[model samples]
Target: MRPAFVAALALCLAALPAQAQQRFKSSAGDLVVETVAEGLQNPWGLAFLPDGRMLVTERAGRLRLVSSDGKLSAAIANTPNVTGRGQGGLLDVALDPDFAGNRLIYLSFAEPRAGGNGTSVARGKLNQADTALEQVAVIFRQMPTINSNMHFGSRLVFDRTGALFVTTGDRYGQRDEAQNPANHIGKVIRIRPDGSVPADNPNKPGWQPEIWSIGHRNVQGAALHPQSGQLWTAEHGARGGDEINTPKAGLNYGWPVITYGVDYSGLKIGEGTAKAGMEQPLFYWDPSIAPSGAAFYTGERWPGWKNSLFVGGLAGQMLVRLSTQGEAVTGEERLLDGLGERIRDVRQGPDGYLYLLSDDAKGRVLRVRPAP
Candidate 1:
């Protein structure tokens, strides 16, 4: 997902429950949460198979498949080794637009390099015989990889045009790289499914040329709005400035240069929150929700939530629902606060239920629906 904007880990006092503890009220009132699967460790991302099964990724670099009957399969072993320190590990997973016919999938992970780790995306065909992946090959890689252990910003989403989008972190010390088109850090890159640059992108003289927009800090959550066919992303702010942005082609998002968040030590970031050349966030959270995963609701089970945006919060330990009217965030609601666990990802399943993954050693996948 977006670069991690999380607080340092504190001593594990009392373990939080793996499931939500109370009935949450939305506009419809009284939300019900049920356990779909359990006994997962740091479940990171999830994508639904065409047959209504789910493919899930774990940060420790294991991939697992869940059948429609909620049976968890053995870990798929072909996943490459990951430098699973801090935020570096296996991250987001996605299915090809034509996965039903193609049986292809994509994954993002922290790749170990000479100096340190960099993010990489690979594609493969899942062979159902042994439930393992085959013909896996890296399609994209970040350049000039750094030595830091944080801010990988590895999330994947496909647009309506069949192009793929990938997010990169600024490597903690290189926040300014987000503003430099010549660098891949802190940027959302657009590419063809086979990892080639699209010729129509805003070309820079000596830049990587795949960058769609620059000046992003760390983006973990991305989804395509069903109605407008537009892209939306959520990222962690420094301390208090988490943001939700509507990304546009050739635009600047103004990360370190303009931010609503102060440093963790309570110091100012840039000159101010606004800059002449930058696009504004659709909505920003002042106290920082530590946004991790997001999905636009298009499930038939919740018809009233058809156009809403669902986001998972790590630090805030909640699910956020935003009512959107043509990119304007008109209303906000919180769900599953009583869960007491850090939410890592949110996805709408093929069966029309909303699924969530918790970010803990004993993390579990949960389903939410209207109470019977």
Candidate 2:
């Protein structure tokens, strides 16, 4: 090697530690996963800060800031009171589209009410120094509280024009509301950054125009296609019908009318799999993986997984990677089963590697990278 070239290589090697390459790794054809960070508490959602820190939400109504060096900050103060029972509590976290310039973050939680509880979305500015939230405000609240504590599907995604999309659940056993136009439950809703209904939304006159799509049962994972910018969601159906649906404006997603799964009590669910006036799922799971926290792999680290969708599986306790061919969902790969934990959230980190949040009292934040 040339002297100058050798000198430059030495400088670069000295800058990065030897363990940096091992910080994340994938082995055994991406089937085996190693731990990155542990001791989390039922981690539900994670958002990346502009400075490369991670903002993680716990199911017990706590928000924690995790550093790149694996240090977790104290629980964030001033989180909204949540009804942490069954499948409810503090949920998804999303950064503002202008987060690089604004330092703003949003959180979704199950807000307790008199008769029942409702899903709520709030936005606040994050103070990295103190690891706290400031100027927090409740932006949107779901309509008509329900008695059940299950099925609060709260995920946030922003459109190209900066409009926010929020998903809600049917509140367990409320099959009829999932298809109801009057109720916001079991629907994908769109709103402005400040939580006002967009004027261009469908049914702007008498209807609750925030609703973008309806008839969804309990959608937990949603992501925008990196190429086409279209929205997609993975929802939990009954026994066998976990579905990945392409959401369309003003369309019903046939929760109670058509499903591949039966009821939890071994009863029939809806009419059948194909029904008129209802949209069909792009793909579905027979035994049900309970998908959550989806993302398109546009990162450079995963060259083979470019444009593919990665979903966390709670019921299957694995990471699912789906190959996409221009709106067609095909080819599934399950990873990290031997890790023995339910993956609740998956996102590609700003460093171009994948990050996963295990859902349990002894949860963990793990990183995945190409194996050495």
Candidate 3:
């Protein structure tokens, strides 16, 4: 309240790093964004343990834990071998539904194979000492590996029925294969936790038994609707037409065949925008947000944001909030407007806060909470 005290406080605050000093406002309300930790190399995905610590993955094939006090642990050892080049690397991480008891975690990574590499999902039990993964096993692999380094659409989501859904990309050079369900180039794959094909999957003749849906370009974000229990996904578009789709059973999404986006060369793409057999998007962004990670906020810490979906904007370098009712997205707002950082993943922490991973050579773990 005094002038001298105010000057001293300003000097003290200015001495702190930007991570602790930055704040922003959103439609929900004003927010305080603080750095939980730093020194992450292109961090891609994050999952929280029940004990309030975090499991975060770096793109260079290491998994690390961030304590509640913002201390980052040494990289957990014994992770599977990843290609770790281009868009290929350790991507997304998720805990098993019963992780408290099973201690099992799943990882999606760019896997090296005979021909080249593809997205692969593996499950392993975390040791009690927090040092390494034990008994790791590959559960699913995108069919037909390719040499290209882009479009490894690798997000892991577990549905209400406990089936794990893995998103596979068109492998850059294979965009046309998205329409073909016989091989798993660009598709949402459904499999049991143990890698078995579900009997309920559409087992049509000539279709892969694990195929849940077909015709996707490069889906990097996927999450379950808190109320409807449906899987929602956000994918990258070439130049425009980034989409938010709720992929359904055995449906076609019409990626390369029909899209609102044009090719990188500014030429028309696909067979116009619609076709008879393909399903439409719930929402889409033109001029492209290049959405990467997604989550539906069900927390009470922030007003006007309950049940709203939060998506990370990679190319846009911000966060997008979508107001929702049940499964339909009704409105959209952009947050962290001038914060020039590539948001790679978004998650709702157990403490009713939102957490984000900034994708960079020197990435950071950022926590967003209500401002006082």
Provide the global lDDT of candidate 2 against the true structure: 0.82
Model 2 deviation from native, Cα RMSD in Å: 4.7
Give the TM-score (vs. native) of candidate 2. 0.91
**Candidate 1, poorest ten consecutive residues by summed lDDT:** 5-14
Cα error, residue 295 of model 1, in Å, equals 0.6
lDDT of 1 by residue, 1-372 (tens): 112211111111011122443467778767777766777889999987654567889998889987645668999868877888889889999989998678889999988989887888988888867378898988888877888889998789998888999988888888988888887899998988899998877777666788899999999999999999888999889998899998888899999999999999999998799989998899999999999999999866678788899999999999999999987998898888778889999998655567899899987888877776
lDDT score, candidate 1, position 372: 60
Clashing pairs in 2: none
Where in model 1 is the C-alpha error above 4 Å?
A: 1-22
What's the lDDT for residue 323 in model 1?
90
Better of 1 and 3 by lDDT: 3
What shift in Å separates residue 206 of candidate 2 from its native position after superposition? Answer: 5.8
**RMSD (Å) per prediction:** 7.7, 4.7, 6.3
In model 1, the Cα lDDT at residue 212 comes to 91
Give the per-residue lDDT of model 3 (tens digit) for 1-372: 465754554353223243654678887678788888899999999998876678999999999998756778999999999999998899999999999899999999999988799999999999999999999999998989798789999899999888999999999889999999899988999999999998899877778999999999999999999989999999998899899999998899998999989999999998988999898888999999999999999877875788888999999999999998877889999999878889999999766778899999999988787787
Q: Count the backbone clashes (under 3 Å) in each candidate.
A: 5, 0, 0
Which residue pairs collide in model 1, if any?
A: 1-220, 2-219, 2-220, 3-218, 3-219
Model 1 scores a C-alpha lDDT of: 0.84
TM-scores of all models?
0.93, 0.91, 0.94
